[model samples]
Target: MSVNALISNYFTTGALSDLPSDHFIDGVFVPSERGNRMESFDPGTATVFGDFAAGTAADVDHAVSSASAGFALWRDTPPARRCAILMEAARLMRAEADWLAVVESLDSGKTLTEAYGDIHGSARLFEYYAGAADKLDGRSVNLGNDNAAFTLREPVGVTAHIVPWNYPTSTLVRGIAPALAGGCSAVVKPAETTPYTALMIAELLIRAGVPAGVVNVVTGTGQEAGAPLVQDPRVRHVTFTGSVATGVGVMQAVAPNVTGLTLELGGKSPLVAFADADAEAVAEGALWAIFSNAGQICSAGSRLVIHRDLHAPVLELLVKKAKALTLGHGLRNTDMGAVNSERHLAAITAHVEHARSRGVEILCGGQATSDPETGKGWFFEPTILDGLSAQDPAIQQEIFGPVLGVQVFEDEEEALALANGTEFALAAGVYTKDIATALRMARRIDAGQVTVNDYWAGGIELPFGGNRKSGFGREKGLEGIDAYTRAKAITLAV
Candidate 1:
């Protein structure tokens, strides 16, 4: 079926009348400097559906120059005016939410429900930051004597945003919203796997009164476009969401320039269920945490650390639930969707194979699927594994698929040790009826974000990020704006 036909039947709404063509940079849909093109594949069909201009290093340089120039004007624009424009952008985004959701689902191979939720979250992020635009103020410091001291919060100039493909729509906006709110121009490198939504957003921002060059998007490989954007002297801040290795590369590229950074990397997050926890509820939480988006999520709770007494019941429930999920095309309103791409599917399969070699028990699903109804899409069954040690590859490394590894803990101490064992400290989940124990575990876990009694207990209002190898800096919430701004001290003699 054609992309349009698929969306028209599945979306049952006018989300996207048609997909946009070309990249948006410097207020125009211009061809790439390299004049190269690449095909975007639909993971559901394992077939190319759209072609996009492949960005180059030259494009990145031009984008940086444009953003630097645009920042000069935007930095001086009144906060109220910036806020107004951001609010308008939010309105426009909500107005086309259905279309945007469809495009996002098509590009990223996520379920339509998940894609729409991400679109809504993106709009809410803009709205939240729009309110913060005018309220971003520095503090006044007291220095004794006849001297008066105060500080002013200012934009950090041009920012480089390297967004991942899994949650492309949300991640792009998550970075852009705050940077724009702080009056910083942005050079965004959208994941080549998913660039359509970003392109349309750039156009909408311009229509909402964002000046030319304020938001430039380059779509291509990280080496050609992303690296230059990070290394460019003009980019004052860099925010990236991807694997740990890529995040490290971004850090190295931006180190010489002393550019500010917000890195949201991968995680092998643990979901702990205590003896007192509800087995069904914890099972449900684990399913949503890891199986959602086919477990491509960075903060997916793929590692389950359960109390010895509760492990069997929770494991039983998890196995049953895993086997029951209806998997097919993302647009089909199925319980689960295909893995993002074939390469990703292969890596996931390898992990399971390695686990088997290590004598790990396959509690439930473990292999990739060839669903007749789903055709050639890269689909993996929601899998659960048992008898894996803490150091096992499947337990330690990030599979980034619908695979969950189980670990039994005799007590709170053991659970804490197991939960905090890995270098990753991204997000963790705790399920227990005892409020005191939940709070205690939340504090002990090394993860940046911890959920009590549920997998995702917080919303956009709360700050989220990771520590250690999971990467530093926060996204979402009031603290997020700080990533894009700097403080300047001002003093007056009285």
Candidate 2:
């Protein structure tokens, strides 16, 4: 679609036109009790695109009450029925993939291609969970001769999902699908920056015959809706994805309630390239790894640790690819889009400038950009910073932008040390042709997930999570459904 046509359609009649400007609760869309509502803006144009009700404490009370009421019936329903409903939801997601992709692209400032991948991944997650819903087994334990013991998995009554704006569609599904599969009612709070896709999915789940209060969506800022929802005593479990600081705050809020938590906090993930690796392939993967969503990813490969022999060749290839990337509005089929928000843009720009001030070499780009076609948007150049100490903020912090820091290591031990030097242990990747070297690095990387030859290689079947400050608990695969349930032991004596 043309840029002008996309702007006109989205501003007047598109996904925003079809969305309900209210919270979804008890099988219906209703206005929020709080009057302090905020409008969502297009990251590409900074245009006010849509508005929704701002939720409050009272709203959280009402939603939790509704979910509690629905829990009784939902938990009693057979697991096969739950699986069927989720399967239908997955079908609907594929049917509406195109529209949802466009909606995600405009709402979150990611390229259209990346948005499509997120929507597709959302469907895959639901489908995988649907198949596993009925497969959760409880083991039988042999006790005394007179007694028979067995265990059963039971759903935690209500769950709250606080998803981030980076990949709103996939992140929202990543939390809600497993809860539904485990027969638990959920109240989802999508990031204020990108709530449209969540609202759309809520409606789709309802249309697939989800029971009243089985799924609900509350839209508002963290201060208003998120805090009250997480702090609610009735909410049994909480899954959040965002910055580490905000994640700590969430943990504190849920501590009183002792709610179950699964957090995917941001990380300064490292990508290590060895002398035996393919320079061109690693460079391409590294570029896509860090810049695909304009570098707004929780596990982005922001830190690059390269072997000295391959450093110059890989750096050159990366710079060439970065310069070749085209930037514009997401709907215009560009390689990159806006930076989600002006505040985020400023933070990313500051990191680059900080590196420059400290006498670091910027191999490629290191500034903000405003194209004439998309005026007044938050955009930054794909940046590469070299010759920096390991303790530098650019190397240790989570920039969460299209900024990559390069470090040269003399040997394998030095490479492993550099990769494990950071406080984060969410994810890491190693590129090498030698199997022994790849396996050794993978085991010693000190990350929850280590991809051998590719970055972000795992799928929905594999458990994805982080360690240390990156947060805990697992999402995706069977572990995801297990997180929403608790085990109960039953014994019978003859």
| Model number with the top TM-score | 2
lDDT against the true structure, per candidate, is 0.88, 0.88
Local error of candidate 2 at 194, Å?
A: 0.9
Task: Give the least accurate 10-residue stretch of model 2, judged by summed lDDT.
Answer: 11-20
lDDT of the structure predicted as candidate 1: 0.88
Candidate 1 local lDDT, residue 142:
83
The backbone clash count of each candidate, in order, is 3, 0
Model 1: per-residue Cα lDDT over 1-494, one tens digit each: 45457576644442334566566778988888879988888777677777888888888888888888899999999999999999999999989887787778777878889988998899999999999999998898989778989999999899999999999989999899999999999999889888899999999999999999999999889988888889998888999999999999888888999999999998999999999999999989998999999899999999989988988888888898889999887777688887878888999999898888877899888888854584678888889988668888887899999999899999899999999988899999999999999999999999899988779788888898999999999999998999988889999998
Clashing pairs in model 1? Answer: 15-98, 15-99, 16-99
Give the Å error, residue 83, model 1. Answer: 1.2
What is every candidate's alpha-carbon RMSD to the true fold?
Answer: 2.4, 1.8
After superposition, the stretches of candidate 2 with alpha carbons farther than 4 Å from their true spots are: 1-8, 11-15
The deviation in Å at residue 165 for candidate 2 is 0.6
Each candidate structure's TM-score, on Cα atoms with residue i matched to residue i, is: 0.96, 0.97
lDDT per residue (tens digit) for residues 1-494 in model 2: 54345556875553455656788899998888866677888888777777888888888788888888888889888889988999999999989888788889889998888888998999999899889788767899999597889999999989999989999999999899999988899999999888889888998998886898988889888998999999999999999999899999999999999999889997889999999999998898899889989899888999889999999899889999999988887877589998998889899988888888888999998999964484667889888998667899899999999999988899999999999988899999999999999999988888888997789788888888899888888898778887899999999987
